[model samples]
Target: MEEHGTTQPGDGTTLVPGPGSAFRRTLLRRMLPAVAAAGLGITGIAGVAHGAAGGPQRTAAADFPTWGTRWVVHADADTRSPAVGMVNASAPGKDRITADYQVDTGRRVCEGSSCSSYMAHLTGPVSGFLTVVAVAIPQDRLPGIPVQGAPPPQPGVSRQEMLARAATWLTADNGAQVSYSQAKVWKDGYRQDCSGYVSMALRLPTPGTNTVGLATDRGLTRPVPLGELKGGDLLIDATGDNNRHVVIFEKWNDAAHSSYTAFEQRGGHGTDHRSLTYGLPGGDAEFTPYRPVAFSD
Candidate 1:
């Protein structure tokens, strides 16, 4: 998806831990059980989207209640609206985007609500921030809240749509913002790790399901065979406790079908398109490929 310059903690030189690192080796050593427990792993494998709520109609600039105002915050702009379905709320884009101005901002003088408390109610990382004054208030009077744009989040997103979003973000603004654990997006924004990237691409609502949770997620089935792999499948490794990675399978390119292409978010970079070739640097025996339960061959 992208190739930028940024590294995670401890390891500064390389984007990811080399094959010899304890993180990698320990995971590989225990890979046998995880793989066997998964019931699918001989040599190679691979594999690889949410909804919002419904409130009231847009109050229109004239009718917004004087006591409180409305707000919307999302990583994307295209799906935002005054009411749940009032503005750009439409089809094709499906990433949950809803906000309450009175809550996030200290506006409307809400009784008890802090930024941290409001953040818990949010869908994904804080991507967009918007505030609207109930009365005809001047823009300058209020803080300069920019109107960022992103495609609307659909109830369900297709594999093609998912890949398309990944491709755009890889090189665009939100791409590569969050690669490290302690770091935020770029510097201050919503940052997506490997699983976060997939969650965003798939328009998933939950954000905590990492590599391991994703592999065994109820929404998805066990790993599929290499021959039946599809464009939207996933290649993941969940052996280590905090060591895991997930790549969105793009396609394969080899005479024996041993190597393939994928999209992922690495520690050094944000989002990237990669070729998982066997016997090479990224190639390893600990990986597993899986697919969505609804995915049909």
Candidate 2:
């Protein structure tokens, strides 16, 4: 097994101390699925797996090869982060993140089902150790590439006419860092892409979500009507195979559903407001929006 460093989770128990501890080895044995699969997210703290009252917790097996999963692990990880190259979950919620599994991995492919392998990265922290946040997303839909073309409805600072809290991803780094330790990715004012915008706006555990994960993640969300969309809603463009995109719903620009202003991470630009029409108006780029009850604004 590859060893680098160790981490002491909230439970005071050492995972990979000095060399390789029994717990670390055992933990690796359990996290095999994560290593074997190329696109599976952290496999921890992301799935609402078979839970018991303080019982064991588990992550779902890698299934969507064409698609993938996304998640984060909020531990003090540094350059020498020793992941046991296996699949295992020790603590009950060891692998669970607040965003469930809807995240992005910043893989830039040609869209649809490509043959490139997608792996999550651990970005350096501005202050502390690298506690990473990652996800699985399509390559073509990474960031920078607008929904259809350039200027993907990138809007400016929100007016905040009526919102519980202002949308904070308006000035992210335009998905520069594919994935990072993502400490304080939300209101901390980090540069972000479209998925990164969603990650922070929704306060997810990680900053990675592509058009694919946005449309099919089955964590704690249910589909809602576009007309019924309120704050904190998501509108994903699941049109073509590789040209999918997503946006955070602010409010309808008009009552006729003609246009609406929302927040997203654009490619040419960083985070900004986007005035959308193609997906909403319906035609080739018909979009489907979903509302997260737990994360409703």
Candidate 3:
């Protein structure tokens, strides 16, 4: 499958909208019904993570509000393309429902940026309840593609050269490129938008890790307290909304009582660390925390 941006009309990329925007009200109404159907029961109540042998055991949802630690409203054109999994409304061989809109169950796996399509597809219009299962792909299984041949080295390369070289080696030269119709060769490609970037940067499995599945599959299924965040850990926005984003924690700022220096790829940049303040956008940023498998070492 090829990755491209969303093409839905009138979906401008903005972090937040003016009060009383139709989009804002529509989003709220859609989200509430889905949240309610997920058995959230009441707003502001914590959610329970299911245990290995048993069903759900009650647990509190983190107090963090909104989607993503930081996000920009991407023009529909820049948004990742849609893919229908077994759960999506457009899932092959499935009947479409007119009134039922899909809601994200927050069960997600990282398959590069393809995860975005999965999330979006499942959350699109639907009337009945839909359950989503998170699944992660191991790195060794990533598909290979052609990449650009080496370009001549420049004289007196700087830090930028070093970082770019790293990206090239991990993505283009190392069998990491994904197929793109527009170019002879494309690196930093995957079914999802950011997955390929993150996977190559961290040397994690392609198609990336599923935040929910990674937690359960690796035996770190317990809900971590916000205070326990450590450098190198992953902070994931698993709301399944467009506001989803992820970051790698670099350190904690005791003076500010908030973590500092985390890495993320936003607005067409490679992964790099910035202050947590910069990480959090003014609007449309939802986030959840995860520990990257690479960092566990």
The Cα local distance difference test for each model comes to: 0.41, 0.38, 0.32
Candidate scoring better on TM-score of 2 and 3:
2
Give candidate 3's error at residue 119 in angstroms: 35
| Best candidate, TM-score | 1
- Model 3 Cα shift for residue 30 (angstroms): 42
State the lDDT of candidate 2 residue by residue for 44-161, as single tens digits. Answer: 2232232233422223322221111212222233223344232112322223211211112232211122212122222211111212112222231112111111121211223232
| Displacement of the residue 159 alpha carbon in candidate 1, Å | 2.1
Query: What digit string (tens of lDDT, one per residue) describes model 3 on residues 1-297?
Result: 222122323443111111233344344433432232232222222112222222222233211112211121121212232323222223321332121111222233221232221111122232222221111111111122111121211221232332342345324434543322111112222223333344334533222333344344454223345556665455666564664455555567665544466555543444344667423435234555555443333
Order of the predicted models by lDDT, top scorer first: 1, 2, 3
List where candidate 1 sits over 4 angstroms from the true fold: 1-52, 56-156, 174-191, 206-208, 278-282
> Against the correct fold, how does model 1 do in TM-score?
0.47
> Which of the predicted structures, 2 or 3, would earn the higher lDDT when compared with the native?
2
Error of 1 at 219 (Å): 1.5
